[model samples]
Target: MQRKIRFNKAPLLGDDLIYVEQAIKSGLTFGDGTLTREVESILQDQFDDAAGILLTSSCTHALEIIAILLDLNKDDEIIVPSFTFCSTASAFMMQGAKIIFADSEIPTMNIDPQSIENLITPNTKAIVVVHYGGLGCKMEKIMNIAKENNLIVIEDNAHGFFGSMNQKQLGSFGDFSTLSFHGTKNISCGEGGALIVNNDRFLDRARVVREKGTNRFNFKSGKIKKYEWIDLGSSYLMSEISAGILKKQLLNSNKIQMGRKIIWMRYLNALSEWAEENDITLPSKPHNYTHAYHAFHMIFPSFETTKSFLKYMEDLGIEAISHYVPLHNAPIVLQTEKRTKELNLCPNSSIYSDRLVRLPLYYGLELSSVDYVIEKVLSFVVEKQKSKF
Candidate 1:
């Protein structure tokens, strides 16, 4: 009998269980407990000694906090990659933003800086970029674009945690960054995230925004007599239970990160030849990048080949799946967004989104299992030639 391989497994390779038990016993399972602050501190130190860090319920919520902080409205436009999770655009949309979707770079599938520059207008207030698959985007270019236009840069860094470009951390480049501790992420706490505020001016407001429009953080720091609702916000706080788990995950980062890196390299090394012969494109390993080792994906020659390859993996009891569909092409966006004036704004986004497939990658995934997956992946045939979606 063959063993089943999962696309991703929620990690438990450390003392997270112990911390969870302690948090429950302490009767402080609410958000902002001691354990939660510790997680925030860990992230702050690791991500460029960030000025303000707030643990949130999810990366999506963290983005929402920034959206509220910016006071976005219909008069303001925000540029985001079409190839990203919906929250990247929807968060700002909830704040009445005009979502301007941009194309992706072929090298890394991150938002293309040129596309971003072209999309910017007088009304463009922010540029949101996702570091797809833990690989850093062209942040230097993106940051320069933002600087030139005086637009805020928000990094939806759910996939890039410790990953870096030019030896600086991925989540540290933007004016504001958000991290995901989703079960599928490299360092997970079942369901948690953090907001990393790099700009000093927004540091105070970010805390209030995360605390449901209240100045509670000020009150806690003895800067105020009482906390009250002062701005647009929500209960975007992460629970102590999740933070307890996250604390241990952070503490065990060395072992976990190393293990995942080894596995990711195994796939890269073994699949190189097979991928070349099959006309499949592996994830880019640029000289300047330290990958977060989030997920290993392949870009097949065509959507048909991608579909067939996924089914082949499924038949072998090895789970593989496709990633985000182009956000501009998503049903909700197509139905609600008014983009008749500028058609096919993100062509590259549609091309890659339809032709990509992601394999399993997680901490403690056995080398032998990884080898088996490599072998099975090598056996798939790519009869279909590259074609339009």
Candidate 2:
């Protein structure tokens, strides 16, 4: 039997268990413990934001915290990419804001800044951009648009940790950004995340919100005699055990990043010729940007070919899969009042929605496994071409 290849496996590149044991031995496995503070401190320094970092239960929770911090109103419109995870829009939607979806551009599936400009209105409050596949978006143009309109920029850097644009960090460009340490991401704590508060004004309230809408953080520091529910919030704090694992992962980040880069390059080099022959589109890395190598994706010739490719990989025991369905045409949003007007505005996004697929690219993935996957892909494409002839 062939060895089973997983779509993704959490990176265990360091003494993760040892740190977890250390947190257990300290007998303080709750939120805001020593290990939690240590992890937060490392991230704060990495993003180079003196404002602060708040470790959260997941990237979703970090996004939620951002929505609350912005104090968005029902009519407030947030321009976001339609080719992203639902949480990106749902977070702001939960705060009663309208989601004005933008289409994705190819060569880098990041949101098109031009589409964002077209969608902005007096009611637009923020521009939420996802750095798709860890590649940096065109922040220079996006930032200028945001500045001219006074719209807030939020980087959904779930695919980007330590990735940079024009030598400046990706998450640092936006007024605020969020990172994911989910099992599939570059850094893993099984399930964890962080909120990067770039602007100082939101820092104090961010702490209070993560602590559940109370002044408890200040009270704990003895700044106030007693804590009170001073604002609307939710419980988003990450447990110390997760933070313990995360701290160790952070220390080994360079090693993990290097290993992933090796795997990504191998796939690119092996499949480039085959991809061109078959008219398949591979992920593009811009000259001035650096990526985290989160996942390897390609655009198949058609939806039928993408499905066939997925099934072929699965038969060979390789776990490859399709990416997100275009959010605008999704059932939940299709029934909304904005359905007719919003659907299919992003032609490229709609085309790729059915064609994009991700191959396994994780920290511990072996070179042999990548080669095997490449071989299987080439074989499948060759067979399809022969059938056509």
Candidate number of the best lDDT: 2
Residue 17 of model 1: what lDDT?
Answer: 83
Q: Model 1, stretches more than 4 Å misplaced? A: 338-342, 382-389
> Model 2 scores what on Cα lDDT?
0.88
* Residue pairs of candidate 1 with colliding backbone atoms: none
**Model 1 poorest ten-residue lDDT run:** 380-389
Candidate 2 C-alpha lDDT tens digits along 93-189: 8998988889998857789989999999999999999999989898999999999999899999999888897889889988789999898899988
Tell me the TM-score of each prediction against the true structure.
Answer: 0.95, 0.96
Error in Å for residue 95 of model 2: 0.8
Cα lDDT tens digits, model 1, 151-210, are: 999999999988999999998988899999898888888888889999989998898888
Computed on alpha carbons, the lDDT of every model, listed in order, comes to 0.87, 0.88
Clashing pairs in 2: none
Candidate 1 CA-lDDT value: 0.87
